[model samples]
Target: MSGRLQMALSSNMAGESRNLGNGHNTNAASPLKIFGHAKSKIRQVFKNIDEYVTESDRFLSGVPAEERIVDAMQIENVKAYRGKIRGIIDVLNRDHMKVAFFGRTSNGKSTVINAMLRDKILPSGIGHTTICFVCVEGTDEPEGYLLQEGSDDRKQIGDVQKLGSALSSTKASEDSMIRINWPKDKCNLLKDDVILVDSPGIDVHPNTDVWIDKFCMDADVFVLVSNAESTLMQTEKNFFHKVSERLSKPNIFILNNRWDASASEPEYAEQVKRQHLERDIDFLANELKVCSKTEAEDRVFFVSAKEALISRSPHTSTPTSVLAEGYQARLFEFADFERKFEECISKSAVKTKFEQHTVRGKSISSELMAVLDNVFERAIHMKAEKYSTRKEHADKLDYVDRQLDMMTKDIKSKIYEMTEEVERTVSSALNEEIRRLSLLVDEFDRPFLPDRVNMDNYKKGLHAYVEKSLGRNLQSRCSKALTITVEEESRQMTEKMVALLPEEQKQNTLNFLPRRDFEIAYKLDCRNLCADFHEDLEFRFSYGITALVNRFMGPKQASMILGRGFVQNIPRSMPMTPQTPTNEAHRTMGSDDNEVLLALLATFSSLYSRTTVGALAVTGLVAKAAGWRILALSGAIYGLLYLYERLLWTNKAKERKFKHQYVKYASSKLKLIVDLTGANCSHQVQQELSTTFTQLCQQVDLSKADLQEEIKKLNKEIGKLEEIGAQSKSLRNKASYIDSELNSFILTYLKQKD
Candidate 1:
């Protein structure tokens, strides 16, 4: 952001940019043609690496190839790095720069590209026309290619004008791209170092925002077109506000286009133009954060893209065609805008791209050097041990194999031991807690034993209360204990696996075998144990309680049990017909005297039922008249009737005996509930124990390949290893020397740029 745009449309002068900190200058003075010097160094580095790669491949191609000793995949990664280095060199030679045109709909972005190219390539119309990003690159020849995203092949095109239909349409389609191979001389701006892109309007399509940020992130310069007939609209400001997150403000150019449209009101054209220009500059500096008012003025340009585009006429010496009077003067602004764009972008393009390529090259060089150094270290390790005879080599192999088998056995034992320890810890805790739960059953039975209560309601209420109590205790004691035990035991297993064998022996086996890292095999699978424990405990308790409740109570009775409504009558589902006496007590109680007394009581109860008070008064008078004997008989009669009604019993059973049955039945039911709860908790413990044991078996696996077959190969390969190891060490030293030199040269070249 500086006032470097002085004398635009006048001369091809190179404006100086502010010096970047860290002793680097944007306008550095170099006697060696910057591109020529860079290209020479780049070619030299590529040749050196290619030679090193060829030598490395030759080493890998020998008998008992490097693939058998080390991972073959590593060589492929190095090859990929080499391919990337060549790609950077190609890009450096082409030096293609990006310049993107962005603004709201119909603000004349395509028109700007058309005028710059001096050709009507982009489709511009009343509504949105250029719907996707059209990247018009400068090719060595006058040709074009269309490549839709995901398409493997590019189709040849004869004209840039044909790109519009393929890019933008209402029909659903994948992303489309157009690469115009414009002859370098088609435009002065695209002559040496830049490619221009005409993007869709800022807010026209939802996907436009994504493609611009993701696909066009590499664009070096951005030109925002505004209608100069008026000041910057709020829509344009809001659009740029979102755009500013991805693009820097210093790289933006504010073009106040259509400045010539004011010729209709020619009375005070200069004043109106000045007013619009000043207003736009202020907005750019304040809202867009364009550094300062001076910088904004330097960047803003007043231009008529339509006039500039149409001014070209085949008949005239001066470039002007069908346009309003005074349009040519307005066209001067467009000329000035082009000059400013070159000053802003073209001047910096070479230096910016050079720095990028240098940094990328340095990184690749450092990575390649590191890889070679690692390979050299591996070779040195192999060369350290040597055998004068085949018998000595066989002895060493036997000793190594025996040590690996011992190490594997110890690891398996450690895993089993951990599983047993955790299982014991939980099982012991579960038993102690279950016995304690049994002691609470007596208190639970109190609700179910209540007289004058609804059997249904009491059963339901007690079931919920007891279930909640048991659930809390199990979660706090059983689940918490199990979780803590499993986690600690798991941690121990992990530690043991991490230090499973002597570090060197494990490493030797890893270098030979496919199992590389020990820690990778020891992943803990107890991530959801705590959650599973809580869910299982709750679900099992609820299931057990439902079964216990169904055995003791009916629907209606159970509902009223908790309401303190005791058994009022026998269950309605049972048969109500009276049976012939079978027991001794019932037969004696139902003899002829008892039958006569029951009939007498039934008749008196029927007569007195409707008129109880009157009947009582008459009985009292009769007792007084007949004397103490008649009164005593009447009192005994009334006592027997009252006892039968209250107890809902025949003459065979007493109320005291019936109350005892309630207590006995309720206690039995409470015992059953406690038993079921304990059983469920025990099952859960077993489940969690099994899970932990299985996880340990998986994590601390001791499985290995049969070494007998490998031992046979070992005899054949051991004799040749010593000879190969000696040659490998010698070649590795040469590779190291070349890598070190490449790193040194890369560092020096980048340091000069810094």
Candidate 2:
């Protein structure tokens, strides 16, 4: 820590406290002292906020228990609020601060970091440089490095020479970011806390804005580096001005680098420094509205980063201290600026951050409560009312039962018709797709294993080409065909189901039909059918691509090849069972995310090559006995593989024999997906209809006694929550009071004019 900060911290007088209805008198305290007091009180108040979030997260793990109980948005709101509250917990636990450096090209941002670290850790240069963001975190060790970028795994580097090459854009992977675990004892400013982020220059690169966007969520303080040679320009002002919309202007620091250059003529240096500082003060005061000119004067820092670096370098003859030897004039300027920078960061309020998080939590919680109340009024109330008038709604429920029966029959009929249509469409499209891919394969007339080039080089290029070719073939011919078939079938299925639905009938007496229950059940059935159809559709798509790749490439070659694009992306396993306890209609959910598709693909791709090699080796004796010729078609994907089983499995001399094999293979996989998918869809539909229809009948069968008993349970839970709310109201009142104190502290201390 710097001398001034340490002195200020030591001078922070601990005050006597007496609680006066959650609003203590903090009259004699300075702003920083008030911050310490208020933060403690605020943390205590947020404990209740924590409990509220924990309880809600547990109760609403995957809420509504049944979809009939609440709408999708209501369930979604609960999860959203739970996430926001958890975010508040994260904010409250943050014991460290993060600072970022942003400026135009060659503004000495990296040099500033190097000077601060007291080591040449970052690469500093002129012109447009620094292609990626580098985040340096304080560490206890000498030095450790994490080199991260692109799809490559993070490489840990301890060697200083290796780290140098990793930092360069051309030498390193694209989007490489260096995470240096810099020793805390080496740097005074970032000793026990600050995580400094250095970004690429703002206006030079084409992707400068995109690279900067990644830091928007993390940056707490921005040190805007400006050259001492120039005044604050429009682009620099505009950059800070745009950022001030999101980040508070008061937290910004103006760092003027290369101050030693201006000091060549000592007489002119003071005038030059004042001119730059004055312009910057005006920009921050008027344009950014951060502060008035007088308040902003001390915020602009002019420093000689080069001089500081020279003083710190091991080869330098000058002593380490700025005042020692002949270095007083050159390096002392950097030391004074560094002290002020440390002071500015040390004074930033802890509560100013938590206040935003608290507000976010409160907003989310309020929205969730509103959603819950609305759901209670609509669904829960109607269920209770329907129970009271059960005797009158008997005929209405009977009519609903008949309609459900008709809906089941119509759905079964439509599904079969659609499957037949899909079969017919797939065969024609599949044949054409096979022809298209086969032509491309035939055109590649190179030796299966090239005689000239090495095997490793041939294997890598060939695998990429095949994966690319299959990807293009899948998108253009295979998946598009499946997409079209699914759309037509789905449209026809919806039309038939809608035609089968019964119209609502008027009742003579004052009665309420279980309309909500029936609608929920019907939608659930519709949802299940669509889910099954889509899963089966994707499975068929994957199977078709596998078959196409198998036919032209041969099963031996196809098994060894990795399929990366389109239909070759093996479809995710159909979630026939509910993953969550609350959502009993798990089978009723359809996901386009293909949640586990990539993981399965990665596993299968690796295993595909190994397993085929193993299987072919085991069957080598059989191929030798049958005198099987090596297939020349599979040179493109993976290097080479041989399948001896094919020698006896298909007789190319007989057309009927070849046709039987293709027909058998295609029919078996398609039928397997259809059978499994249809069974899951049909079973879920029956189970869901039985469960939901029983619920509707029970609601229609409820006696007044049953209704009264449920109301008692409902009111009891409500009363408990209301009691908790009262306590919450008191704590929030305390939070509000302390928040007011913090605002007062800011106004009373920070904003006071000189």
Candidate 3:
């Protein structure tokens, strides 16, 4: 073989004092072990916070809409907090120390990761070998497996060649990643929970932002593997700049790989190494400002990854080739790089990974406490307001009750007094109408042609006519006055009662009784009340003379004695009889013609004393001279008296006596029923006014009942709000305690230095 081929062939023979299995030296004394403990505690704390958020959301959602202090939007914000807390819990569960490598193509980026593992796990070549991001982490399984993004099936990684071929043959975007799970027992770095990620060349992919967001966001440290023969490229530097923008003070390391190429130029080996160191340190310390210059010196390294990888192989041979001159020294440098990287990654990952979680946990707890506190305070305020409003409603209900009670008494008293007044008015009017009963009987033009056979029917007609006329007259006089008085009082009472109702109910017409015209019906019927009435139709001397005078002197002179002024005219005709006694007796008779007829009959006895003797002597002399007989004259007189007495006098006496008896009977009957008719009218008025008052009372009572029910509901709501306030206060206190514990315990541990 040639000398270059022999150098490559003899690289497996190199061995050193250090073992590759203890690459990170992650024992009990290691910082990574302490960080892992802290990480576990942080995950538990986040899990508790996640549960708190979920419980808070459930509690807030169950509150009644009327009783809720927080609106819908704020409650939704709490639910959003639940989602954020769950996201934090998921991140905490999968947390690991990650280190991503970035560089131009063929800068030995994959070779650097393989050397760290002390095995060629990642594909490395002279061109762009890494087609997509490849992540290598530890798994507890005995067999290794691979998982590509967007798929769940595991592919067995039997060997590096097969894994490399699988990665090379895959059609994946530059941003997509392949997860490689190697047995943790084989690599100390993987055993310490270190995940190494190798990316496609920075110069090959333009989507560095996507790559950083998708894969590098959780990375604890970034390694920039550069070719030792060239200067640091801008494409490689820009990737870190973008990374620093997303992460605060990201941990970065510079690896000057392929340093063995400088062996051919021995004269400038020191100069080239010095130049690469200065430029890389300036890029990190001055340009990025991620760390100071002293910190940057420890972060940069010059090593040969190929030589380091070959030196770690399980072989024992001494190679003496030209290219293998400084292999042992390069292997030492790689070991030193691993030691420093372990320390840096352990401390940095603890702060970068868990620090953010702690900070977010503190913020979420504080915000939750604030939300609970706000809810508690709002509940307290609402509870107080409800109590005050309930008190107002209760007071209003009591006031209305009192007003209704007093108004009921006042209205009832007014109705009683008005009913009495109606009774009195009806009684007085009925008495006045009864006193005019004779004129009413006279006005009956219903053709009462009385005879012996039709006497009963005539009496019935007269009785009905008097009853109807008296009832109509009494109703006309009494109804208007009583109606006016009762309506005015009822209207006033109605207005007072309506005022006691609720504001909304006051205008509702259906809630109250409608107004109607007030009236008391008068239905007096005296059809069969009188049964002992008798008319005097026997032959009387007075009726015979009155009929004879009417027949001889014409009907006009007789009507003067029988008409409405007959009693006054009778006193003038009987001048010789004591006038004062006769007028006094006539006045006592009162609308009856019996006393006048008796006086006239007594006066007719005197006509036969002195005046009739002289008239008979002259009449006897005239009859002898006219050749007429005394018997003929006597027969003519007898015939005239018989005709007048049987025909006109008997009928007139029967008709007049019938009227007089009917008037007397009707007057007595009307007087007897006056109190009863007045009482009925009064009772009717009482019923109307009482019913209106009763309805008004019902309306007031209904309003009072409704107000009382509302007060009860308000009291219930106040109690509910009180319970809600107490629970919210307790939750706020608990959340505040958790926030303090997170700040004092978890944050202090995450921020501690290695």
Candidate 4:
């Protein structure tokens, strides 16, 4: 051990001392003061020494030191002192320990555990000894309970026999965990110290494999029990591989069970035992050989659970000697078993302490070195690299800036032209078609009205003539005159309007116009004309006109117009007025004339309305199409240009950032090293150099860990953003469909009108 370690241990043995300051009273030089003060001071000193040794031991054992020094003169004294101090401290703290037992199925695993406990809590047989994982701790109750996953509720295992039934009903597999707490009355057996976890048998059922694996991983010390009959089976090898990967520190305990079977041929048995031990050691290095419950030490005894329970009743007389021998043999195994168990526990504890010490030392050393090399040295190198890369990126960004500007100008100009072109095409086509139809209809002249006296004045003269010649027929005579004049005018207008439209254009226009529009326009024209005359006079005149016109020209005009046909035909007869009483036998003849006049006006209004509506619809369609086309074109151009710029320039920004961070870290480490060592140093400065080197290593490790964490977070965020972007695309596609539908409707309407 190093001088420091020896001195610390010796000081702890000396004892400790204490001091209490005095204010006034001394009791006149009392004899008690001299001894009391000295004893107190010694005790205090010892206490301080004990603390120092404990702390120093922990530090040395946990950390790895430099294996070789550059100067041979320094190596023997310095490194040896450190190593000896570390080893001594490590041994001192390993008295208390924990061990975890594990192995494959039918490997005498439970047998060995039962031997250690000196009781049979676990079932022993062929298929599987342990169905569920059980953690056995020294307690007051020999009770077992089941803990459920994701729940805090515990169910008591009141009966082991009923366990299988309960689990079967619930469909829970055999691998389910069962925790058995030893009764407090029996706590003395275990000394209330060690915690034994009897894990579910490995290779029991395929379904239970996961639980077995989990138990092995969580175990602190590994006890691998293989049957003496078969040492290291294929299943056992597979289990070992898994344990080796997960556990950093593992101790192996091998049990050679069923020694009674070999009693008849001791020599052959010994040879077989030796062979088995060698094979097991090769498989799992550093394994302890343990005998079965029947042959082991007195403290580590086991009983055949089935026989013990069955033979408890006094009905049959079985030899007490025979049972006593069996029980004695079981108890004898306990002594050796307990000793081995204690040793295994102590060694495992020591190993754990050693591991912890080494880990701490290496951690500190690595951190210092990493900070100096990666953080400082790399930082400076990266900074120079970043400068060059940033310059190149800047040039690329400038190019993109120019491209974006040019793209904007080009897009705007193209959009304007597209809008103007669509608008002009739709408007000019629709208007020209409408105007041509209108002019054709206007070309025909109204019929020339012959020179005739005012209708009322003529009517009076005619009445006088009629009364003088034929007194009773004057009304009839007046009617005849009116009829002839009306007929003549009606014939003229019909012929003129019919000739206005070309045969083909007229048919196409009539087919295209809606029926409702025709009805509305024709009604308006008739209403205007009919309202101009006195009601009674207009009825007579209108009736006479309709009848004469229908007889002379209605057939030819109707046939020609109907050939181009609207949805419904105009009726020759007028409808009866709803206001007329059903009981009336006589009615005025003028009612017929009123009906006829209304029908003619309604027809003209309908046709005119159809033509006007058609024109408006065409104009609206053309304007909307032009607007949308411009917008769509503009959007497309903008999107493409934006993507182009991002692809070319955005990546450069990320690369530059990465480089900058690397440079910053490296520069910081380099600066720290220079600051710690001063600008100029002699070659012989060994102690100072070693201290600086150690500090540098620790810093570098810490910095590297920080950078790794930062990078991990960045990658995670990038993945999340990409997922969100994918979801956005789906929504955008649905929205685009709706927009297209609306645009299509507008375009169709416009084209139809044109």
For model 1 the local lDDT of residue 34 reads 37
lDDT of 3 by residue, 433-501 (tens): 878877777676644455666877777777677777777787689888888887888788788888888
Per-residue lDDT of 309-355 in model 4, one digit per residue for the tens?
A: 22332332554345433433322333334444554454344334334
Stronger candidate by TM-score (1 vs 3): 3
lDDT of 2 by residue, 1-754 (tens): 3343233334333331211111222344222343344445445546555565555444444333443545666556666666666666666555455678888878888788876676677777666556567778776777555655443454454332243343443444224456766767665445536778877667655554444456644565678899888877666776676677756654677888877676457668768977987888888788898877776876677776766766665444654544323234434445545545555554564434545654564565455454444433334343444444543444444554576567557655755554455444434543454445434433433333323354334334433443355445434643455445444544454443333233331121113422222111101121222222210101122234466567655666566544443234545588786467545445334233333443444344444445778446634644566555543232222232223333333322222332333334433333334434334433433444444334433433343234445555445444434444444444445444544544554454344411
TM-score ranking, high to low: 3, 1, 2, 4
Q: Model 3, 341: alpha-carbon shift in Å?
A: 2.5
Better-scoring candidate (TM-score), 2 or 3: 3
Clash totals, every prediction: 22, 0, 0, 66
What stretches of model 3 exceed 4 Å from their correct place?
1-28, 61-63, 68-74, 125-128, 158-175, 203-218, 229-250, 260-269, 287-289, 311-329, 354-356, 374-726, 745-754
> Considering every candidate listed, which one attains the maximal lDDT?
3
What lDDT is reached at residue 592 by model 4?
A: 54
TM-score result, candidate 3: 0.48
- lDDT values for all models: 0.54, 0.52, 0.75, 0.40
Query: Best candidate, TM-score-wise?
Result: 3
